[model samples]
Target: MATGPNGSVLVLTNPHDVTTDVVLRILADRQVPVVRLDPGTDLHTSAALTATYRTGDQRGTLRTPSRELDLTEVRSVWTRRPSPFEGPPGLGEQERRFAASQSLWGAGGILASLPGAHYVNHPWNNRAAEYKPAQLAAAQRSGLLVPGTLITNDPDQAREFATQQTGGVVYKPLWNTPYKADGQAQQVWVREVRPHEITAAVAACPHLFQAKVEKAFDVRLTAVGNRLFAVRIDSPDLDWRQRQSLMECTSIAVPDRVARSVSAYLSISRLAFGAFDFAVTPTGDWYFFECNPNGQWAWQPDSITDSIAHAVADQLENGPEA
Candidate 1:
């Protein structure tokens, strides 16, 4: 575990997460040595699972034997979205159990044990970022205006909250994660809150209700290390996702307070990268919504890509603590 002069970085991701490729290419162009860890590899204890890659125009699997990673020699890691492991259909119950348990515990443990390495989005930090309640509180503590919010399983409480807001409310699921039941993908749809529908909403799941913000413009503030890129998104629809065709997005100058708060939020959240969503009123008030730790930014205006890429490379090269 020797800390070398030029350390290596491991990119933890699926093949399709294009941002991973974008970042990797930036690192490679700078001559940084990178080892890509494909998550779909078989799990048989951390020691037994040797990973191999098939290069361009190659056919059969090239089995690169397993070796323990030298954590001290590693500089940084990017924990991008990983694809789940898939085992063949013929495995019986016992074999299936062995593989599944190893995937969850064994692989996860190895990643945790890596020492003195900077992570753009660490696994533990990524987990903490998912709780919407905590994010709202943190945003306010960082001096950003967060829309009044309520998280509840009770129907009556939800109804009261909606009725109290002068401007109407909107409902967002705590986590927009989908569960597959009988081969169907169930997605959480973001929608306006009607006072009459509170009963059915409460019956469905624990709801996160917030006053719908009236806006002059909506902004997505993307921060990579110390660099910040703010983009103003214009959409007439209640939810921006609803107006993909008609919406306009453009880069905007971020207010100093908003920029400061965004930097502070990222520092407190222990993240090197974040995509922050804000709703801005015509009077110039910016209300913080939430920051996506693993947010998508390729959809943002093309001008931001270089800034983001450069920020990531600079952090990866010099280390975030520096």
Candidate 2:
């Protein structure tokens, strides 16, 4: 539906993202008033901001090339993965750092305070939901079956946990961040960890260990509002993501219980969207893995992709669900 002239949807993400490309295309078709702003790269480049404050309240406007979005009339804000906040043009490292911090509190504070705007996943809520431990607890509480898991920085704890799990244990990174190795970016992959291999080096940082879940397949379930789009991935590898080329993806219906559990998780996490990963065993049971609150969906089939885009656009244009 075309948005009325009074309100606008603010899409926050980088330009190169395909997910942004597709969503914006749909919003364009719907004639939704959208301000596609990449706060990081656009703040000092093509964007300008102004605000007025009363003793207890604040109001603001953000001007992009084609639009001046009324922050007060913003229906929603969809924050994807934007680039890091660039401080100012032609500035030194320390000076840039200071400016970025100021920008984050200054402009960011006003945006976050927009009274009527529905955040797909509020920035603060998104950050909190990203933690592995936090997500696991929410999934468990939401009634999804989760594997035996442990988080520890002690080598002895890691050894004792691994020895108790019959199917063996695997070490998975607590967070997904690339590391520089030989001047190239690399990520740690999930691998089996034998109790004998546990060493004092495990104490260097927090490590996530879980009982190995032998699975018939994996599910990439992307949820937008109340809709769940599940794609079953059949792969022989320990991590299907490690070898996407060999994995076969097929659309599947989510079990009613699974759907309800995910919805409950979204409520507990205070999120409007989530991309969940589940391990499906041969006996047709599902085990909770993790959920990416701001995960990608454009890679799925056009049916799923377009549906999610439209669902997201609907929320942005129409405000919160009734």
TM-scores of the models, in the given order?
Answer: 0.86, 0.95
Check candidate 1 and list the clashing pairs.
Answer: none
Positional deviation of 80 in candidate 2, in angstroms? 1.1
State the C-alpha lDDT per candidate: 0.76, 0.86
Instruction: Kindly report which residue pairs in candidate 2 clash with one another.
Output: none
lDDT of 2 by residue, 1-322 (tens): 2234457778778888888878788888988777888787788888998888888766788988887877777878888877777698799999999989888888777766677678987887888999999999999999999999999999999999999999999999998877999999997899999999999999999999999998989999998888788999988789988988888888999999999999999999999989999999999999999999999888777887888888887777666571
Q: What lDDT score goes with residue 140 in model 2?
A: 90
Lowest-sum lDDT 10-residue window in model 1: 55-64
Predicted candidate 1 versus true structure: per-residue lDDT over 1-322, tens digit per residue: 3346488887777667788777778888989887667645523222233232245321111122543455556778787887665533368978876766677575665564455678878878987987898799779879999988989888999999999988999999898777787999876666788788788548567889999888888888888887888888898776787767888998899999988998889878988889898999989999998998988887777778767777777777668753
Residue-pair clashes per candidate, as listed? 0, 0
